[model samples]
Target: MNKKFYFKSYKTKVTINGETITVSRKGFFNLVLLRLRTQVINLNNIQNVKLKEATNFKRGYLKFVVTKGLKHRNVTVIFNVFENEIAVEMKNYIQTINNK
Candidate 1:
C-alpha cells in the first residue's frame, strides 16, 4: 500500500493517489471563477514531466504529457513555488511512480 501525498501551494495541489497523480484546484470560490478544472493522470500514462520555476506573484507549473499527440496540456499549476521542496518531492514521487 502507498500513501497519498500532496505537493501543495496556495491555490493548487498535485496529490498522489495510488498509481495516479491528481491535479486539483483548491478553494470553492476559485472553482466558481475558474470553472472547476481537475485532471487525473496515471503514472503509466505519463511520458514526460517538466517544471518551470515561478517568479514573484507567479505560480510554477508541473506539466506532464499523457498522450504524445494531444493538442493541449492539462497539468498541475501551483502558486508561490518556483524552486521549492514540494517540487522536489513531486519530482521524486514521479520517479517512484515510474519505477513501479
Candidate 2:
C-alpha cells in the first residue's frame, strides 16, 4: 500500500450512507490509534459506486462513497481484501498518535 493522504480530527460526527461515522475525540482517536493507512478515493462525482476494476481486490483496496438515499457527506469504508473479506492492512504508511 502507498501513503497518499492524511485525516484531521473533526469536532463533530459525519454521516455517511445512513451510518454515522463518528470522528469524536474518543472514537476517532481509537481508529487512528490502530494506525490504518489507506486512501479514501471519493467517487461521488462519478455518480456510481461500482468501478470498472472494482472486483480486482488483488490489485488494492477500493471503496465507493455512496450517497443515493442519504442526507449527509458520502463516504466509503475501504480495506485490503484477503481470502473473502476486507483486510485491515494499514500502519505502514500512516502513523497514529495524539491529534494535538
Candidate 3:
C-alpha cells in the first residue's frame, strides 16, 4: 500500500478504499517499540467525521472524530499539523472517502 500522507506521528497508507494508520511510540530507555497500536478504520464503517481546527501557532492541531455509531466506539485522532496545507488535504481526502 502506498502511503498517501503523514499526519504528525501517524503514517496513513491508503489502498483503493480503506487505509491503515499506524503510530509507534518508543519504549523506556530509548528501546525500539513495535507498532501494536494501529487504528484501522474501514471507510464503509465510518458514519461521520468531524474536524476541529486550532486557532493559533501554539495550538495548531488537527482533530478528527470518527463516529461508528453504537456498535463500535467512536475514534478520535489528533495530529499536530503546523501548517494548514496538509491538514486541508487530509480533511478533503477523508470527506471523499465518506462520499464513496
Highest lDDT scorer? 1
Tens-digit lDDT string for candidate 3 (2-91): 335554433332222355333232334223333333456656666555566545543344444445566754554444445456666766
Clashing residue pairs in candidate 2 (N, C-alpha, C atoms within 3 angstroms): 37-90
Better model by TM-score, 1 or 2?
1
Q: Sorted on lDDT, highest at the top, how do the candidates line up?
A: 1, 3, 2
Candidate with better TM-score, 2 vs 3:
3
Alpha-carbon RMSD to native, per candidate = 3.2, 14.7, 5.1
Tell me the tens digit of each residue's lDDT in model 2 across 1-100: 2222212222222222222222222245445764433323222332333222224444333233445455433333332223112112222111121111
TM-score on alpha carbons, each prediction: 0.68, 0.22, 0.55
By TM-score rank, best first, the candidates go 1, 3, 2
* lDDT-best of 2 and 3: 3
For candidate 1, the per-residue lDDT at 15 reads 67
What shift in Å separates residue 27 of candidate 3 from its native position after superposition?
7.7
Model 3 error, position 92 (Å): 0.9
| Cand. 1 Cα-lDDT | 0.66
Residue 100, model 3, lDDT = 57
Clashing pairs in 3: none
lDDT of 2: 0.28
The runs of at least 3 residues in candidate 1 whose Cα sits more than 4 Å from the true structure, single-residue gaps closed, are: 1-9, 28-34, 68-72
